[model samples]
Target: MVKEIKLLIKKRQSYIKEFWSYINWGIIVCSWAGVVIHIFRQTELKKLSNSLENVKGLKPISLTFFAYLDSLLTYLTELKKLSNSLENVKGLKPISLTFFAYLDSLLTYLLSFCCFFGTIKILRLLRINRRLSLLTLTLKKSAKQLLGFFLMFVVIFVAFNSLFYLLYHSYVRHYSSWLDTALTCFQMSSRHLSTIPDLKKIDTFIAAMSLFLFILLVVFMLTNMFVSIIVENFNIVRREPFNHENEVELIHFTIDKIRQWLSMSTRKRKIQTKTDPITEFPEKIDELMLAVDKLYGNTKR
Candidate 1:
């Protein structure tokens, strides 16, 4: 039984090693391919823009592209309804879906370049630890990647805001008339908000609070999801014995082993005896000693 168990552990380890080996190669190839594709895409976009200039007022082409974009956007919005089901689709795990969703968000913002490079770095790091599970490593990598992205986001956000303010002061001041007209148009377009005398203050506060609450809710949901996955994986690792074959089998085997060891120890203790010879032979020894004394006294007499 011990030999069989050892064999199974060896087999499992071998499988894990092979799986990681394949994964490492796949990651390397995919990363290189992604870089090549990105470069090709940029070149293509440049060529496309040059081609667009030669075509006078490609309104039809622009309309078709916009039409497709609108359809795609509508489809994606509707797909939200199936988010729960899509998450558990056949061969697709929740973590995998979450990862793709993160990628999709990054791609939409043209920030996938950061993710691509981050993934390559993560893969290289992973190659150093073959014993680490892919899911565990991926979760860790995803967290670090997200942190990097958040930092980038902060830097970009601050830089853009600063640039915008600088441009606003330098350029917009020179177009004060245009700015005034634009502000007036915006105010006129949004006159309904100002015109509501009775509900104006109430609406303003409610609107502001509602927006704040919505933002908070979104942040809470995302945080919950991230924490939940980490906790779930941690729990799985905690409850599972590293060398256990199956969880159920491991539990039964552990119980049996404990029971057998207890029984053997109990039996061994029962067979062990410490006898007192004086208690069992007290008469024989006393008579022999009395006879010896009598013989000695008779000799003396």
Candidate 2:
């Protein structure tokens, strides 16, 4: 009975640790979500203000602390003229529906991606699961390659999307704007090509080429590389015990760097506090400083 109780207590502690890790990941994901929310809020604020006949009457909106106060002050100062300006306020640009949807869907996709990874992290709580351990270790080793591949894909996606947007926005009458071009490219890569309509022959050829590129790069090359990486690293993971001292060292190094950065200005400020610049230097520079100061003093005299 005592042995069973001890085992239960250990398992409970392990579960709590895993829960804490999952919560930490959730907090990190929430930070990213906050950024996305702020961006969308800015966009929506602009859309709202533009829709108003008198934007000067609208309240100030910003992500900064004193933004609302600044906007309020500006609006109050222009309150007398705000009524008069409403008569001729006809220059508001129509906001694109696709762009609005794109922003929202992008956020959803990102949140889902973070949650998927967080779920995987939580799954590591099963201490008896060797497969999970191996998978995690393999991913840890291949992290750099995955990041590099992601950056490469981003550059390619942006470049081709820009090319397609430029081509379609000019020649194809169906595409409403450049935003549609980006949305279409994203959709095509995901194998959801129903929304994009038919275009000019040249535009069609570019779209087809983009589809082929997505297949060749994202679907085949990167996927195959990742598979190979996992298989190669799995052997190493199986042979080596789970060692986290490197991660602890890395965390410590990161914290030290952050501390140094935060104190850098304070250190500089301290150096500046010296009335005589010569006093700020180490003893090694004292001789050079004395020679320069004496020469300058003599020259001035």
Candidate 3:
């Protein structure tokens, strides 16, 4: 019994530690408030940091403040220096094709993580701009879901690209190159296909059949599948905020049930009370309520 209590206490301490780690990470994230960190080499941070002093505008801010800002800026520059190794992360600079796409994905994730967890929490604490805070949170959550949907689309689009490439290569002459076939498949999958009049050159039966199936897959099957996944997962994300109340109720219900079970045990009242309590999670309120009824008796007719 004492061992179980020790384990629970250790587990709880670990969780608390993780929560505070998140807050400290948030602080580090907010420390870079005004300075920008460029990704994908969009702009050179070195040039900005070096020239901050020489830029001519009557510097209204105090030198002490600017010097302190430069100190924080040095930490960022050191971090950027570490990123020199990522020169080849997004494929060769010559060709735009990314070597592996997940590197690009990591950008969105870090951005959302910092903004949603760090900046959003800080803004909420300020209580000055609730609407903006909510909007930031909504966009962060939605972007995660949208990124999943996009990756799914990429997989399906690749499969269909290969299928259509084969079909066009074997039976059709209108598509002059494999790249053309891929672009066509992507266009159809994205529902951005131009009018059918563009395909007037292809008048074969196989071509027509393939086109029919392409439209059917894009419009009828894949579109609905993607939409359903997005809607379902979006609801799951929306439900997360209410889970705290459910968890609290579950804790209370479990305690009461355990108390009753211990009091009714025949092994000896004190002996039962001394035993370690088991924790149970009710996935739904109805399940918890039903368990309570079974234990305490329900008055419903």
Instruction: Give the Cα lDDT of each candidate.
Output: 0.46, 0.59, 0.51
- Measured with C-alpha atoms, the lDDT of residue 192 in candidate 1 is 25
The digit string of per-residue lDDT tens for model 1 on 1-301 reads 3443465477876745443444444545555665565465455445444544554423323312321232456646544643543443454333222333333343333434445545655554443333444455446535655575557545543443343234333333321354543443234233323422332333567435533443343334434555666676556555554542222343444576787878743222233345687776987788999999999999999
What's the CA error at residue 77 for candidate 1, in Å? 40
| Best candidate (score: lDDT) | 2
**Could you give candidate 2's per-residue lDDT for residues 226-298 as a string of tens digits?**
6776787777778887544223233445566787988742221222222565765677588898999999999
TM-score of each: 0.23, 0.38, 0.32
Best-first order by TM-score: 2, 3, 1
User: What is the clash count for each candidate, in the order shown?
Assistant: 0, 0, 0
Residue-level lDDT tens digits of model 3 in 171-270 = 4543446788776676666777663554545455755776688778666777887677656655655555532222223344557678778885433223
- Please give the range of 10 consecutive residues that has the lowest summed lDDT in model 2: 265-274
- Candidate 1 lDDT score relative to the true structure: 0.46
User: What is the lDDT for 131 in model 1?
Assistant: 46
